[model samples]
Target: MSKASRYEWRDQQASLQERMKGFMENPGTEQLQAVLTEMHAYAAAAQDGSIDIPERFIAFS
Candidate 1:
């Protein structure tokens, strides 16, 4: 993808995170754990090359 597109995806992910924060504002402990588990899966997928992280994230390195 183009650099601009990568940036856009990164922005979208950030926006998703913000939205999730609101959705989870009063989540129970189990719900919080589930969110964390999903996040870990997302990270693992990215690390395993099963998912492609946006260039903006790569650029952070």
Candidate 2:
């Protein structure tokens, strides 16, 4: 790789490392569970035909 490409790769790797370090510091289990529960509720609603599937979700049959 050229010198410029090597520098760019180092910068990208450093940014990714920083993001990963920050993510490791806050795992947010409770928040994740709550969101999962909400998604399950939405899935149930869609199955029941009472509510439409959310626009952003691509649930596989």
How many residue pairs clash (N, CA or C atoms closer than 3 angstroms) in each of the candidate models, in the order given? 0, 0
TM-score of each: 0.51, 0.44
Query: Model 1 segments beyond 4 Å from truth?
Result: 1-19, 57-61
RMSD of each: 5.4, 16.2
- Give per-residue CA lDDT, model 1, range 1-61, as digits (tens): 6666565556646655754685578677766766676577667766776545654434454
Instruction: Tell me, by lDDT, which candidate is best.
Output: 1
Could you tell me how far off, in angstroms, the CA of residue 28 lies in candidate 2 after the best superposition? 3.7
Error of 1 at 31 (Å): 1.2
Model 1 quality (TM-score): 0.51
Q: Which residue window of length 10 is worst by lDDT in model 2?
A: 50-59
lDDT of 1 at 12: 48
Q: In candidate 2, which residue pairs clash?
A: none
